[model samples]
Target: MDTTNSPSSTDTDDEPRWKIVGPGLLVAATGVGAADLIATLIAGSRYGYTLLWCAILGCIMKIVLVEGAGRWTLATGHTIFEGWSSLGRWTHWYFGPYIVIWGFVYGSAAMAGTGLALAALLGGLSVAWWGILSALLGLTLVWFGHYGLFEKVITAMVALMFVSMVTAAAIAVPNVPDLLRGLVPTIPDGSVVYLLSVAGGVGGTITVAAYGYWLREKGWNTPRFMRVMRIDNRMAYVITGIFVSATLIVGAELFHAADIAVSTGDQGMVDVAEVLRDRYGDIYGTLFLVGFWAAAMSSLLGVWHGVSLMFADFATELRGLPGDHPDAQAGGRYFRAYLLWLTFPPITIIFWGEPVWLILAYGVLGAVFMPFMAVTLLWLLNTSRVPDRWRNRWWTNVALALIALAFAALAVTEIQKAVSGVL
Candidate 1:
């Protein structure tokens, strides 16, 4: 993109070396929680190695999505929210309520997910209490800590998740020949839903847009850091691919081989832990639970920090405050307000589970977001809103278009399923 508008280039030009990892890792780790892991495992267990290409495709598409977000920030010196605001007043109308509602539902879901992992580890506590504890812990960390501390803690959790999941994959003894065959992209019969779900759901989410905000938090606010951001984005998703693929291997080796069906929802991961315990030993089972908790908690931490930034920024703009205002950034009043919104009210869901109507609404809202992200990002990166050099190239447009189509289809299906469930 155009480096001229990048305010930080003058200061960062002499910096010695670029870090291989950054906010990208946090974004990737946070996006793939227990539900994602379980989804990948379910795909593997049901279809063996048939859906490996789908997961890889998901990672590639996310790289494009995140790169677009980071590019906008670096080239134009605006957050993604600001870019959306530039589009029209309607952007505000859409996002203002969307963030509020999405946060309320997602908070409980995220906490309950982490709680499931914690309950698996500490049977003395019920899942509801564990979920509440997880939400409180995430709230405490984000409310008290700044970006540096948040980034470091998320990095540590990513390490724990990587090591444990990969080790478990290795123990599963994947069939090399079958894995190689999966790369060729053959969909087994009756696997259309699983195929779309894996391809579209792997690594893309609301958090992909958070990449830019996280980059700002990491002191990479200029085009000079563009190369580093790309490397960071790719590396993070590469690790995501490895982590996801390993879970698939676990599913293939354990559930597929044994012809066992995993449970549904967050508890499914707990079932996997039990499977690990029975097939391997207690230590392996405990290790899997640790990894599960890392994935869940990292997601809780990531959204608590990242989306809160988005929310705070939205609130600031809504109030006509400057983007750089303290209240719009980390550990500020607006930020903490959104953080609490994401941590507390959802606890009710933990105790009673999501009400039927609320669950349906959340499903409908969640279904549309990825497609919204893909479409908006495609628009944002293509126009003069971004620097000419950073505009979406032909390949980038192609990828995003495909992502939009894929996610739109998935959204339709999800909405149908949600409605059907309610009826």
Candidate 2:
């Protein structure tokens, strides 16, 4: 498949090896979507830099999770799904419905997010229509595009997002004293929920589970590449840290004024873009929206490609196909079906309001997934599933245990909010 200009080639390209863009970069771009941006923005606007440490902590948590995923695949020569199946059939029972329902709802949400930024940047259509268009665009790319091409495009978008937000924050001139104070980790009254969101929500999703697949695609799937995988994972989250913290800095500097009211959710980013127009100039505002669009689109594309690859694998395994089955790879029949699954039907939700029940089910299922992933990884890596040489070290097990507990708490909180919203 189309392999020219693939970032994977950087391994020996003699190009300046700065960040070493690879599966790690893809996971980084995929993990930090619009929701993560809004969470940090809200935290900053409400409490200034007081929650900055949470962003750091969130990244550390994710690093552990992604490392575990990658390690399992390299050590066991099996996909994550295969590892889970060895545990028993219950995993299939839980994962089957969760992936299907989660993809449907998440597809609409992602399209709307990209649409929001697109409509703001270009004024010809409603956010919903723009969202539908974005879905189609994402579908086209992932459906026909090779992994190498996809990686290059994601790298460009991530660069735009990083530059736009960090540059905006720099122009705002952050208060060093306030920022320094934020590192002390004291939670103000009523800051519990926002703190939880920032600490746990930095950059995570089922896409973290897809890290291994990207590793295999990049030809990094062996014990020999363990050191490289660790570096790639660390650098990815380090980049994630900058993306999120720069957004928080933007919130703290631009939206902290008493006159500015920050909207919750991804729309809040659009609101900030308008503020940018007034505060900076048309250039800055347009830049900000373009950055936001890059972010939303990068994330949508990542999920479109990564998670669909995952679904393809899941389907292939269920059909008793070999691990090397063609239908499980990117652009294969199963993968294309999932890409279509993520694209077309969600357009109806974007057009007319769909029923709430399935969406709520999606919410509840999605909420529990972080913990599910964490706990399962803890089990898989600790037991005989992975080789003794590559099993979790003491520190790794502790980290995963703590992550599982933290995610369990966040899942419960998310479920409560989902249920309360319906009531």
Candidate 3:
């Protein structure tokens, strides 16, 4: 199996095993943050096995979006940021401010989530200290570890999360009949929040844009790698789909039976763990908590690495510099600057509460990003920029259009909730 993403490969007899798995795993793992888990768990608990179809749909949408990202990279030999830039300066105009602001706000939140999960698993430290430590650890690893090293770490963490979480689900022994019923794909009454969450939040974010950067790092630079890239992206999301489905199954079987009410936010996973402990035992609950920590940490590391690369590219391009120029690649001035922005400035938010207005802005920016990425890819891939063979198929365009609309609707509701203090 050749791990090289270049078009020079000629080996015809290899197994093509692990080489097929690329940065798609990192993207899928990064996208399935703590928030996604809680959403799935809540969906299952509130309406047992009813909305499983949303999770499946979410996976399909991700595959389409990610493949678009990878296709643009391989076809054009340009990053997604560069592809977006081909449209005009306005693409950078929107991305520049959004990346900086999003990083500052999300950095604190992600580190804090990782810390909370670690605090639950390890007994002595407060969440604040744990969060600070987690942030530093992520910074250290990515600061030294380039793309390959970063991919290995995220893959291992995601694997640990899959094992423990799925094991817990297996122990729960969900009813096959009810699980099958979830395939019908209907939204139940009063399940608006759950529906939006499962449909919109299943393994998605601005990090999807990072797919190109990771492909670049993986050395997938030409059209011949297209088949391998597609396989990698599909396999990664399928694994993500399984992990999410297992979470839903556990939620339906365990919490639905007990009538457990899950709260909103990352802490909801902890709440579920407690319920599991009461019914099953400490070992089961502890194992699940460990899995939860792995998920949170994987997300934290991925954002720390991927978004820093994005911000670095954004800053360099704003200065009219090239990507391979000295200051745009890993550990360069722009990259480290964004790294500091992601790791340090956000600590202030940890001390002083996150400002309501800034939080609102974060929600607004985040809401727009998915649609922005999808719509931009639709434009980039459809034009003469890519060869006809690499251009989106009819079904691909339809899927992307639906994804854009779905994300737009979700964004509107998010803004409304932020305005109403309901999010």
lDDT of 2 by residue, 361-403 (tens): 8878888889989999989988877778778877887888888
Q: What number of backbone clashes does candidate 2 have, counting pairs of residues 3 or more apart or in separate chains? A: 0
Model-by-model lDDT, in order?
Answer: 0.85, 0.85, 0.84
Instruction: Give one clash count per candidate, in the order shown.
Output: 0, 0, 1
TM-score, one value per model: 0.94, 0.95, 0.95
Instruction: Give the alpha carbon lDDT tens digit for every residue of 105-176 in model 1.
Output: 889888788888888898788887888888888888888888889989999999999998998989889999
- Give lDDT for model 1: 0.85
Off by over 4 Å in 1: 1-18
Clashing pairs in 2: none
Could you tell me how far off, in angstroms, the CA of residue 42 lies in candidate 3 after the best superposition?
0.8
lDDT of 3 by residue, 1-423 (tens): 111233433431254746669789988999998989999999998899999988998898888888889888988887888888899989877888788789999899888888889898896998878988999999999888878888888888988899978987898898899889898988888997678788777776888988888887788777777767877888898899999999998889878877978878888989878877997899988989988989988988888888888888887887889878877787888888888888899999989888887888788888889999889988998999987767877777888899999888888888787777724
- RMSD per candidate (Å) reads 2.8, 4.4, 3.0
Name the regions of candidate 3 deviating beyond 4 angstroms.
Answer: 1-13
Q: List the residue pairs that clash in candidate 1.
A: none
